[model samples]
Target: MSATDPPPKRRASIGARRNPASQAAILAAARAVLAEQGYSGFSIDAVSRRAGAGKPTIYRWWKSRAELLIEVYAAEKGALRAATTGNLAEDLTAYTAALWDFWRDTPSGRTFRALVAEAQHDETALEALRGKFLPERLQDVRALFGAAVARGEIAAAEVEMRLALYVGFNWYYVLTDRLVDGRAAIPAAMRLVAASLRD
Candidate 1:
């Protein structure tokens, strides 16, 4: 309580000690487990041991494995990142590049694929994927498409269709034989998406 006492560290949540180092360690450990085991197989016990924290400490912070996975996802998934440069092509390129880069990195890439497969059977997981992971990326793309529509470079009517097409085409390559290695498909994806949105 003395003035000489060092000011407290920045607090993130409403009621928790805010030590950046601890949080980073926990998150890093969680990511390693998520990447290695996927969300379904991951557990707080393993995460605690890996994080060098106690079970109570982990439980004190995260209510459930789902909550842990949620944080793991937000921190790991770069696909949710977006750009708004006022140029549609640049915007899409930036978004897709970030996405491909994230996917190419083994940490998030393997986990994301597992998440997709998990979503196929789990309703709650599917909801989280759509509401939390999928829409964030889609929103940015929609905004870029809307900008192009405003500029008269593309029709507003085809925005949703184009986004869906882009996703479908890109995912097609990832799912089939891992052949979409950005060799001839990345720019082609950009081109196909751009053309699909054209007036």
Candidate 2:
């Protein structure tokens, strides 16, 4: 191919290059790589190779493996919409259990563990993890709690504290304690959040 030549054909994956669907294709590929390879083994070359994308494409979108993996986290975790209902306890339990199920049943959870460990050294991943991804997830849960408040099911003061309290307390379990054997844990915490909505 010469400078005048056109770009290669686009991949149908989550983060391909040149096409609008490329981003999605690449992220899917990245998740696969992260799952198979773990933190130290994940790489742009691997993801692009698997994604059928160019190295430049990965670099263009993500600054590092952590960034790419985190995006997968954001998307799968519903960065925009966490859950469907606003029943407070029902929504919280649903989303939380969904999250636990995601980690326990899929390779994504392993990648998440790696990402968490890697975040300690990489300030960029840490910032992305804390600022954007975490906030967005919390916001979704908060909205649910807010709904409960509107319904007089819970107090407004306890809304923001829901996800943190749950995630913070359960972090060790999901990260190291093992939430499931080969299936979902049902995440006992999700129930507590709902039950705690009252006196």
Candidate 3:
């Protein structure tokens, strides 16, 4: 009440402290919309309606629909992390198998494929795909490869080249009708990939 007293502390901006519940709702609604309608019908408006959150709230967390989709994919995929077992072949086998299962079995897997399709002509979407999503995933693979090299299981010079080959092999399955039918073939694929990278 004193004149010298500062005004009561103002509440911090909503943007400063994001509610986990709001994020969960938005992401869940995003996945549901993406699943039911695919990328063609996904929008901030649709998600806001479904999540009971405002458009500004969604935008506060994500810059664009594609960025939001990336979060949904990451959430569904969970960290893209793998533990190195000090054996290159074993490590590659496990990572490859897990990656394959993700793209082959999950709804978000299909949503990712649809996003890939959408990105072919949409520049913003493609930028998000290449600049954000792919780099995030590549970093994980790079770490896995780095660990193998540290243990002297694979050569130092082959990491990037090997990563391309590994990802391209899986991408081929995403583009073809070879995913499920190709599961039986992954161990062989991993062996070949490991052998190619071995000193």
Candidate 4:
């Protein structure tokens, strides 16, 4: 190849440079597919067709459907906050109720459920759940608990145990299709936690 000759054709890098518009299109397409087709119908193939992008393009950016789903959930869920009210029990109850409402009323619920199921079989998904998603969620819980501690409602030593209990309680309700019942149950559960902390 001579310098005078046309420079060697450069191959476009795969996902090396993410175009913001293209990425948004893919995420929007993913959300549409999840909402319309449900998790069972969700796939890179489906998203590719919907986004007018190729499988390689989607795969280039999101290695697995689970990774794509995580992005979709994060985009859709946005920031979650509960009422502070300077009361631990009220804060917990409000937070749980808000979480239940989000899960039951939006596409996020199904997307999350699918992600959880995928993690059971996919190491990538499992790592994302543990390393990324759960920590973000726990941060919110910690903030709420930290507020409670500041109010002198609970000792600092109890936050970790309460955090675990709070997460497990929410997971059990969501997984069991008990979000409806969870509304009434949330206040009672919050009161129990508050009582236990006070003891």
Q: List the residue pairs that clash in candidate 4.
A: none
Segments of candidate 2 deviating more than 4 angstroms: 1-18, 78-87, 181-199
lDDT of candidate 1 over 12-50, digit per residue (tens): 332456356767767887888776776566888777767
How would you encode candidate 2's per-residue C-alpha lDDT over 86-149 as one tens digit per residue? 5665676667666677766666665777667767998988987777667765676677777778
Candidate 1 segments exceeding 4 Å error: 1-25, 35-41, 52-67, 77-94, 177-183, 196-199
Candidate 3 is scored at a TM of: 0.82
Alpha carbon deviation, residue 101, candidate 1 (Å): 2.8
- Lowest summed lDDT window (length 10), candidate 2: 181-190
Question: How far out, in Å, is residue 128 in model 3?
Answer: 0.8
Give me candidate 2's TM-score against the actual structure: 0.73
Over 1-199, each residue of candidate 3 has an lDDT whose tens digit, in order, gives 2357554322223784688877777788898888877767888988887777888778877888989999898888884568788776677778878887788777778777778887899998899999999988777678878887887777889887888888888888787857788877777776666664333
Clashing pairs in 1: none
A best-first ranking of the candidates according to their lDDT comes to 3, 4, 2, 1
Q: Of the pair 1 and 4, which is ahead by TM-score?
A: 4
